[model samples]
Target: MNRTELRFALHLIGFLDSVEGFEDGMVKLRDRRWLVWHPDVMAALFRHDRDLRHPPSRTLSPLLGNRSVLWLDGEEHAKYRRTLAPMLRGTRYQALIDEMVERSIAELPSGPVGLAEWTRRLTLRITGRILFGVDDEELLAAFTRWLDRRLGSRVRTLAHRYLTPGTTRFDPELDRMLLHRAETAEPPALAAFLPPEDLRDQVVSLLFAGHETTASATAWTVYWIDRTPGLAQDLLGDADLLEATIRESLRLSPPATLAGNRMSADGMVITPSIYLAHRRAATYDHPHTFDPTRSPPPPGAFFPFGGGVRHCLGKDLALTEIRTIVTALLRHRRIHLNTQRSCTPQLRGAAMAPPPSLAMVATCRR
Candidate 1:
């Protein structure tokens, strides 16, 4: 590994807003390693997933375990996706998600709340119920502790990558709880559909991927809505506009900056930078500005979920949860930003997250 390049990547991923002189197109980071952000290149790479393979197992195996879908490729990955895609897309699950969102919203604390923390809990609660088939606070809290330790900071993220057997104190027990829940869960629980052999890793990966990324995205969307004058009120009436606003929020602060790294047949490593692609002026008018009124992005120009057959299986579920929470919260309460200063993205594990200090105060709507 090129130590200097690796360090630069880690810093950029952790603190995306700090990046300067970022350009579109393919950037060669090291011999045989490249970063591609140009919409055309991203489209090409995503279109031909078979030509590219995932990063080495050691990179993610420690945190997600050996059998995580993130590590699978070719037929194995395709089969896994086929099994899970229908469940996530099922209308039956949408009803369950709406119920969970309403319940979570009812529990939202009155007065000032940290946006990141509040959303994290909301998503964890929602995701836990789906994956574990129960709302066990102890399990949720333990998982949070474990996740925070692994991806709380740039240092921790790097160490987790380079260190041997990167596990927190909550392991073994948490693993057991997740696996047991998945195996025993009945229909309608997401865990019930998961394969038994890969139960542990799959459940862990789903919880982390399902909640963490959505939590960050949800928080960022709320932050932007509060920042824009009259936008929240407008959203209450216009469903399409509400989606557009969320899309804009995603464009500004994509939860995952780089789609997973892909290895080419010739030993070249290529990664599509969603962050960069979304910022191209050609694709987005006044790219840096947050304007939901702006024209919709072209097909390849916008990809909060990575492109291709490898696109996130939980995309529909995530959007449903986000839309439900945002719609319910807006309808039930009027929330305003606690600080005048804007919030920026901070990398939390694999997600680009809002800082914990970003807060808002909510008052029930009369």
Candidate 2:
């Protein structure tokens, strides 16, 4: 790898003491955790996923709640998936997504704006309406405030990571407030679809999981389109190219850098690296370049939503939201990167997003 590529890879992987065995398909970190990124190994792991179990997450439980599907294993995890899968899959929410995208596009802010923040708010609003069945601005704003105060600060985030266990991160006051708002919402919101017994935890998990990742993906797609000459115009004219562009963007910079950590009954711990898996030179021609025109990737090679039975539940919904937002923005406004700002990859909680300094200017097309 070239110097530039090596630097990008490091940012994507975050901190690791050694990559000495990476070329051999798996590498052991300083913590003795193994990350496997090779396509064959990853595929095999997923294929035999029945033998693997999700490792409970201490850091996330307090934030996402103890019962959150993120840390659940065995039948508990499958039950959560079963309850939520039907609602997320298929064309059930496509119209709702397209409507939200158009509304967000129609109200585009004037002048240069932070693209990451812009997309975050947009997705937050959409997620709130669809998931909670309410568009209470006060509630959404309060939720953001709570999360910002806790996870937004670099100092607090570090302290939460190293200073204490994950369960310590939960805020009871905020949790109660969020749950009350969700419970009071009228029927038809996706929140109603969740079982009431687990409503609070499920609401917290869905909202937290749904918004930021989609927003990050949207921001990254816009960045790629802005940097590639005439790409926006090409996307406007062809639907397939727009899809390809979104796929390419996800492949290049998936919002979530890694899949859930898994452990075998035999005590073998393995983590799948989506970032590394997507960038393998063997699987992608010119892996570092953001080329949307490349031919389709092989089946097991491009599992951005992850592989196996535990693949992301929001796959179709996320793609639809991204396609709608990108297509709508390109159709209505001309967007350009604010080149004065850095566009480096930075970690935002669990998601990898364009740096906060990354700005873009969107003006209406005459």
Evaluate model 1: give its TM-score.
0.92
Per-residue accuracy of model 2 over 43-159 as CA lDDT, tens digit each: 788898866888755445667776777777778788878878876653777777788788877787787788988888888887787766667778778778766666664455555
RMSD (Cα, Å) of model 1: 2.5
User: What are the models' TM-scores?
Assistant: 0.92, 0.90
Worst 10 residues of 1 by lDDT: 13-22
Looking at model 2, residue 158 earns an lDDT score of: 51
Q: Give the per-residue lDDT digits (tens) of candidate 1, residues 251-302.
A: 9889888778788777887867788788776677688899998887766788
Clashing pairs in 1: none
lDDT of 1 at 106: 74
- lDDT values, one for every candidate: 0.77, 0.75
